[model samples]
Target: MATDDIKDTVEYSEDVKVDEKQNISQHEGIPRPEDLKQDMALQTGEADHELRERERKLLWKIDLRLLPTLSVMYLLASLDRGNIGNARLGGLEADLHLEGNDFYNALSIFYAGYVLCQIPSNLMVKTMRPSRWIGITMTLWGVCSTCMAATKNASGLFAARFFLGCFETGIGPSAPLILSFWYRREEMSSRLAVFLGSSTVAGAFGGALAYAVLGHLQGAQGLSAWRWLFIIEGLPTICLGLLAFVILPDYPASAGKRWLSPEEKELAIQRGASAFNTDTSNFDLRQVKAALLDYKNWLTALVYTGLNAPLASFTSFLPTIVKTLGFTNLQAQLLTIPPYIAACFYLGIMCYLSDKLKQRALFIIIVSMTGTLGYMFLLIGNNVALQYLGACFAAMGLYPLIPLTLSWISNNQLGHSKRAVALAMANTMSQTLSVLGTQIYKTQDAPAYRPGHAICLAFTCLTWGTALVLRYFLKKENASKDKQYGVPGEIDEKHFVGAEDMYDKHPGFRYIL
Candidate 1:
């Protein structure tokens, strides 16, 4: 097919979306800006075979260079954030003399710092660049995590956890923005799954690591096993953070200096064609306000919060929950492994299928429904085997929701600043829910924790309602735009650049459902 034809046929993906306004014929006659002229030629020319081959190579290089490093960074970030749960099982409560609700406050306080830092960290990522910003945050949080080993009382542990949350805030919001910088929208779901799947991997790894440290290092070096757990886990994360500073690349246009060759860099820039370009060059309060005012942003946040509450509960108390099935501490840690493994596999499969089929809402609904059933089983089932089955179902369902919701919103939002602010806002609201989630699995609800299970089931149902409403709104907006214009109106890159602060309001942009 010709360049125009190919552009017309291009799917709604992260890398390329078919714009209804522009035509190949018009593009050939238009004079582009000097900096963009080469990129425009490379795109509009009839070098189909060469473009395809180069694109294939470009994607492979990106997948190899980027995914593994980001995945590992996320893995350590998740591990540090979650290790407190494992340590709780390793006697952190007893060691610190945590009184009634002190432990709960410790968990909840982290989210206070977490909620406060998300927006600021997200805004800073663009200015400081991913390498410096993410690297700095990771290293600092690793230090905080290590200090958890030295805490002498509940207050000290609380302080350590709060700082851990502050430094770790950059990660949860940054991952999706960074992914958008590299992959096409269609390809992002699976890549995001890989990145976010770190949480599940951390669960399995955390359990196994806890089992080993608590089993063998109970008093090694005259420090308790919980202390050893913090030190051992925290040190490697610091090392990884230092490595990320040297290795992680910036956005594509600016990345050749970071890693890629000049030729590869050009390809990378072209991959994120100007049509859906997000301006990360400057900060604007208006963009922040726009994201705050946008209903879609808050709606997605609500759905995400409901889904995420269960995940937070699982991460903090899975071992405790499993132990209620009559297993010892060590046995509970070992038992937590299988469900996380199952969740990991299930997440991979669902992300792959979600991308392949080009759908998000259906998959989210199905996953939420499955999680609801899992909680139902946990609440009502009597047999130990059935309850264990419920645990697997519950865990497998919750972990994938965040990534899917993130990719969904990232797909919908148009501007860089808008997306950045929207994502941070979403993260803020979800973490707020997470704070409430920590309080749900109270010390009073020991063993069966029937109340916690019931709350989770309620939230799962809430997820379904919010997701469907968002889907309906997106469809309505698309339909309305289709009615208003017979075809898409013009979108000059010059005009877009000038008004990037008003992204998604333009007639040319369309929301993907």
Candidate 2:
């Protein structure tokens, strides 16, 4: 198991499955990359231990340094999207003289802008510094939200909301690419959960904050308090954007000048040793087209599209949905907090287990199926307690799946250009489905949209079917490769033997099921 020998292994097929057993228990004592290198030589590497330990550190850093900034940023971004729900609770409908899903149509129109902006926004973040690009977008979206505070009519709201979507597009997706810069595959899910749970928290937090603000701003500046909610919620993100440029580290290779030690920099560089997106080589249209040509990217997007349909409903309208179920505005906000809290813990545990087990698809399948059942509870259950618990079930089921699914794709797509585009493409595709999900809560089925419930159930079933299919495909491909040469993924065997060429040539690095 010498370094040279470890580097020499060749893989010939795209489905190069390693043994499913994670060997986590065995990788306990090894510390330091040097030890990891030695363990690699011994063929008894404490890789899992190292990866988990690294993930733990990253999650801590991300939660403290990165997520808070992004959370505030996304809270504003999410607030921009769903303030209509809050406005409906306020006097926006009467003031705007709107009737019958015009607001929903306005909400729907925002995505038309979103779909147009995301790809370009993401591409910019990659070429420019993420800190610079994301920070700038944060400031811009804050301005857009503030403008929403000034809307006089439905047409005004529509204009403000469309611009809001344009500004908000890259904030969520950029956060993941930034995380992917630092964290490994298994570590991504829980971190993603922690970052994303902020939106849910904002629903609760905004509920309370909105109550306080709306009540306080009722007379200020001749605008409604709901308008003030837009002003108040939107401003912090503007300042946060300035702070991000000053504080948030660029990428690891570029950031150590201030915080990370030289030793840490080296480790950071190697941490990406298993980077699915390794080659940042030359780029142009041909490369972009070649990256897009990979079937796996679209397949991943399909899985995410169906899954995001329900999750988007949860985020964009959960507060409104809860208010319909016989709760006061204050009560709805408080109630929303508990389910999101439940999601944080459930997602953390699931991510911990996914990492421990080193598996992705099964967890996704199970969580998704669980979410489908939760939606069923919404459809059939009449008891308030039970229906509320379904909200918690939705959290348990939906939130964890996000991190896992993104990690699955991030770990699958190779090449930085490819991974970046893949993230945007998948998210963009999923969001398109979300536009449909939003419209499904039709005016005709206002209080309880049984059709929406039924559609969610349909999406979850598709998730189950996709997971099963992916599992078999991965296994079958791996076996095929192993028989032809040896290993997973489709890398050439000759270069694989070179000290620096194992991954370069190993033809069997198959996408996960």
Candidate 3:
């Protein structure tokens, strides 16, 4: 079946009772119910085609409006966060008087605020207008990031980075939650790949930008090249944040009032209702309790933790790691670009296949093993060429897991509140480990960084193992549901009445394994 046809079938099935009601009311008791059913059957094919066309247009409009704005916001966020690594090579450490472990401490302290704010920031995104909340946070973080250029010592850098993390938590962790509000589970992975893929672009763009700034602008006006890097990268984020308030849409119920027709708005809301348990209160504490208790949340959080340690080490240390491969400072910065570009292509392909197959855990396992192999090469490779190959493998393997795991956790949860908490909870656990990830690549350990490679390798292996166990449990539960429910039929709106409270416990709901 065509993609639009499948979507039409799902929506039609879910709305069958409503269609029946409309059919019966139109008959006005002039005909028997059987006649109404016959008439409805005749009309169904044409109705499906018309609705599918409208829906296809609606999706295109939404994709155009949402994806680019969110992608650019995330790109700026990634640059501000990761540019510190680029700055490090441009003499940030020497100028700031950072010595020994002070540089690592600077890197790790950002996550202190990051970990603390995950749950609260995500909840705020739920309660406040998403545009306002995200815009305000973006502006604040931009300010904090720009201020890093002014830091005269390790203390100043620590304060700047810590605040930057606090504000940035609103963007990185909150984006998937925001996207969940607009998209269905089947549609999420690819959309999220676009959003998360910005970080890869940031990696590539930051390198080229750093090379230019560090080469030509270093001492043009008495500021170091690293300071100029922070200034140049941080200023554009402020402008984009302000623009978000004007461009970013809120929830579908209220979004596009000026643009979407009433029918389109109704369709959007129904789309959200079909995918999520929408009967519950928006901020129910009970949902929070349910999310905290769900074993799936913890299992996925473990997988996230495993991925983040390596992710943290990779993003912050990739330049440094590349530098150790017998390249000059400028050359190291330039060389980091290709791996990220390769990862971007790799991520797009994997995410497309993931969404097309409607599978998450299997792809996650594949990439985790790929990452394991990457680290194995890095750990023991004898030549610089072999080690560089490891870097490409590591980038390819690690980048896609982020969107996959995030969407998987989001896909399985039912209520909005529960999903919000689950997303934040998983990120909270994973980010805590990221603090340790920052410190693993010690300064003294460089020029080989064997222990760092080994630890990351172990974490990737852990990701693979945990994903296997989680998939097993999810498959088993799906089996239990099929047995108890005797296989689910086409969903109808009637099935959702009072079902929000039951969440994933609802008999009609099935985990997407």
Best by TM-score: 3
Q: Comparing 1 and 2 by TM-score, which wins?
A: 1
Candidate 2 lDDT trough over 10 residues, lowest sum: 496-505
For model 1, the stretches where C-alpha displacement exceeds 4 angstroms are 1-46, 487-502
Relative to the true structure, candidate 1 reaches a TM of 0.88
Candidate 2 matches the true fold with a TM-score of 0.82
Candidate 3 lDDT, tens digit per residue, 1-513?
333343234323233343465554332324444554566667888898998899899899889989999999999999999999999999999998888899999989999989999999999987888899999999999999999999999999999999999999878998898888778899999999999999999999999999999999989789998999999999999999999899998788877668788998888888888786474326878889999999989999999999999999899999999999999999999999998998899899888999999999999999888899899999999999999999999998899999999999999998888999999999999999999999999888879999999999999998989999999999999899999986877666765666678988888888888
State the C-alpha lDDT per candidate: 0.84, 0.71, 0.89
The TM-score values for the models, in the order shown, are 0.88, 0.82, 0.92
Cand. 3 TM to true fold = 0.92
Model 1, 1-47: lDDT tens digits are 43345444533434443345752223333332442555657766758
In candidate 3, residue 357 scores what lDDT? 98
Ranking, TM-score, top scorer first: 3, 1, 2
Task: Assess candidate 3 and give its lDDT.
Answer: 0.89
